[model samples]
Target chain A: MAQLTMVQALNKAIADEMERDSSVFCLGEDISDKDGGFGGAFAVTRGLYEKFGEERVLNTPISEILISGAAIGAAMVGSRPIADLQYGDFIFCMMDQLCNQAAKMCYMSGGQVKVPMVLRAPVGATQRGAQHAQSLEGFFTRVPGLKVICPATPYDAVGLLKTAIRDDNPVIVFEHKKLYGGKRVEAGAIAPVGEVPDKEYTIDFGKAEIKREGTDITIVANLLMMYRAMEAASHLEKEGISCEVIDPRTLVPFDFDTVIKSVKKTGRLMIVHEDTYSNGWGAEISAYVAEHAIYYLDAPIVRVTTYDTPIPFSPVLEDYVIPSTERIIESVRQLMDS
Target chain B: MEAKMLLEMYEQMDLIRTYEETLYYLFLEGIMPGSIHQSHGQEACAVGMLYGLRKTDYMASTHRPAGHDIAKGVSVKDMMCEMFGKEDGCCKGRGGAMHTGDITVGAIPANAIVGGNIPISTGIGLSLKMQKRDDVVVCFFGDGASNEGAFHEGLNGAAIWKLPVIFVCENNLYGASTSIKNTLNIEDIALRADSYGMPGEVVDGNDVLAVYAAAQRAITRARKGEGPTLLELKTYRIAGHSRSDGCAYRDDVEEAEWFARDPIELLKNKILKEKIADEQILADIHEKNEQIVNEAVDYAIEAKEPSVDDVLLNVYWEGD
Candidate 1:
């Protein structure tokens, strides 16, 4: 086992996949290392351009629409493509291609073609204001043909990216900006160091990882919120309240059984995410738990999510809007008391 | 182009026109299921552009897909079945009239969104280049699609990557009854290609030989790895954009002007004057094309609708 950052792990996964399959090439803006171009906006594609050459590690113009559409076309015609957008917010620019063409090509073609493409979009709020920062997994999760994954750890990032690259369908993998321990570090960025196995392994979709064990309540979270949930759990342990944490690796093929099992044991559940509170991913989790595991819940299911407002530039307002550990702790303590 | 190739283009154009006319007649009789964006007068554009293409070369079509689908060799029976929402459709009843296509013949599902298929064509070109394949992709769209943001994005990408794609914009004068004059600022949509660093050409879309010659030049340039070319064919759809359109936005004077230069008629006169084919031969070709359309209609009408269980399938592919 070797310790690696999330970005490093992702780079390794893409490099390995490209090496294993030549058809697996990357296309995005500023993804190349030549001509002083950044190896992607966050350095996730660093060294890949040098290693795989320009053809595989491609750098396109500022065109998310073309990038997504081209990737779908390539996938439809027997080539695998992994397209990346500089930010998750730009996903809207290519929504038609991502949602309509890439997502529906196989279904519309009657399974005659498979769009084996992965769209790597870095999500989550940082200092960047309304346009750049957004937890966009919720938007894409609603799209049926896409496999949406939110990886919170380096191990999960590496394995899941590998799986997404090889998967014979369109996969949207949302990597949190804070978890990317690259050279361009953001303020309040938590360094995620985890051991990645030396051999090739892939984690199946719809599987949830229990980050921590508990008996009183279950805290379901993903991406940056998963770290907050873990922090809240640790602080609650000092107060003699145990909170089990569940990280759903993927959203569409959600691991309801894992959350349901944990809820069945703990008899309480709390869902948290950085997406807006209204119609957020947390709401879906809450609805699912209510529908299937209502009897197991000792109290009503609660959701701790970002406020229904665009992310602001000021740190205070941003922190206040996004769900903090204090908010998660308060929500969990109140649920337990009830 | 050879005489045989020119004749093949004529037959393709005739087939597309007959298919569209049949669809229009069916719509008028209230027998068709969905609205159609018929490409009647613009037959030569699709036929000339696609006639020389290999079956494996890709084509990305728009809402007006009949002409491109016909020229691309899409199974007319399956296309008709798709329009009828039958079980054995090329799209298996999922994609209807506007989204008709068959991947077996290298037609990606026709994108309904305006300018949506441009980027997809660029991606196919990228794939072909990566796979070291000699195939080039031809993306068909209306004049208005040239104004979409995707049009700029896709063309810029194609130019930068030097992908093997020929963007064939059938500038049919109108976008859903809104004239191109109101939507575009440039004289020709081909001029907009200059901004993307690609050669742009405007061909007389009603002339099969002219359209075919232009397409052959662009396709040859693309296959030679020279890069993408924008071929804006100056054509017009003889019918309305969709089923409900009454041609109110268009005047009869304009209609008469275009009808006088109809592509099928242009080819028929040329064939007769040059003695390339006798009037009887041309008449027989028209009769054969009508029969093909009729047979497809019958086959599609006889096909069954998909079962409910199939609705849940193909959302995601299942594999190890």
Candidate 2:
């Protein structure tokens, strides 16, 4: 096993899957070129076209709608397509094709057709602005037929992407822009590290990983927010707060069982996310936990999220809007005190 | 040239008409579950086009897809069962009238979204071409769809790739009551094909023979690596956009005009006028068709409904 960044893990998964299945082909903007824009905006698909030919690792035009529609159609007719959107925010242009057509086709056809496609979208606030920085998991999770996965570690990124490619249904894998250990325009950025398996393997979805062990409180988070929650847990450990951190890798078939069991032990729950507070993914988790694990809870669940406003381009406003480590710490301390 | 091929065309037309009429009555009786976009007047376009296609060749149809589905060989029983929301229906009762379709029959489920099937058909064509298959895709859309950006994008893409696709526009004048004349700048929807550098042809859609002849030419061209064609069938819909409306938007004069030249009646007269079949043979064909339809209804009525547990099934394949 070797320690790899999330970007390296994604490249490995795609490279392995390409070698494993001849049907798998990747098409997106700037996914093919070597130094210019290999892999993607995060370099996840770098060195694929070099190993495979241009035919397999295709560089498409800047048409998101056509790219998504073509991927859906290609998948329907029998070609496993892994389409990449530069940012998750751009996925709005192709939502009809992804949501209505790809998601509903097999079900609408009564199990007659299968859309075996993987859509890779990079999400998270990196101080880019309102257009680029958005945690798009909330939008996609609402769609019924789509499988939404947001992997937090290198191991999970490799395994989950492999699983998504092999899946018959269309799967949307959202990678956090800040979490990818790569160069950013700004001075400070998130660069979480994890080890990845050298051998080929895939992890099952709907499973939660307990990042840190504790008994006093449970901190639920995903993607970039997961790292923030982990940092918050570390700080609380010094004060004897002993908070548990749970990361749900996949949102669609969420691993609620693991979280519920952890909540039972801890007797307190708190959710942290970068998405807007109103109708964010944290609300769903909070509601579910409140309904099922109410008797086990010691205090009301607290949610620390970005303010209900569009992501601003200014660094100061953006920092204030998004949930920071300080905010997570405050929320956890409040829950524990209560 | 052959007599059986001509008879097959007529049979398919009759089947479409009878099936639509049956669905109409079922809806009127309050037995059917969903709304329908019937293809009462455009049977010739479906029967004529599909009659010439192989089972391997694919067809992507529009909202008014009952005719195309039946003509392309979707079983009547499954279609009726689907309308009844039974599990045994073609789409396990998930898709209703507007989306009625069967992939095994070489028909992707009929898309209810206007012009949505254009790019999808192009994709099917791409797959066929990539695999080096002789199969061609016939994408059936409405006149309203010709004005859609999807139509332009899909057609341009298909033409540039020289993919084997037949962009069939069943231009029955209106798209949900808004006349094509109001939406389109050009008089003939087929003319848009010239912009894509593909051959565009207009045919009397009500005339099955004319439509069949045009389809044959396009299919032959596509089978070779000659690229795509846009065939605009000048036809009309006798029914409203769906089951609820009375189609009052259509002029009575134009309605009477199209009815007089009914594709079913036109084909019947051609058969009788040319002495292709006698009264006895016609009677026998009608009786056999009635029996087939009756048996289909019986099978559909007796079909099972999917359990609540199965709702979660088929969302993703769990590997056999």
Top candidate by lDDT? 1
**lDDT of candidate 1 over A130-183, digit per residue (tens):** 888799778877888989998888899888998899899999999999999999
Q: Cα RMSD (Å) per model?
A: 1.4, 2.2
DockQ of each: 0.77, 0.56
> lDDT per prediction?
0.89, 0.85
Colliding pairs, model 1: A70-B123
The CA-based lDDT of model 2 is what?
Answer: 0.85
- C-alpha RMSD over true interface residues, each candidate: 1.2, 1.7
Task: Report residue A187 deviation for candidate 1 (angstroms).
Answer: 1.7
lDDT of 1 by residue, B267-288 (tens): 8888878888888887788899
User: Which ranges in model 2 have alpha carbons more than 4 Å from their true place?
Assistant: A34-39, A183-187
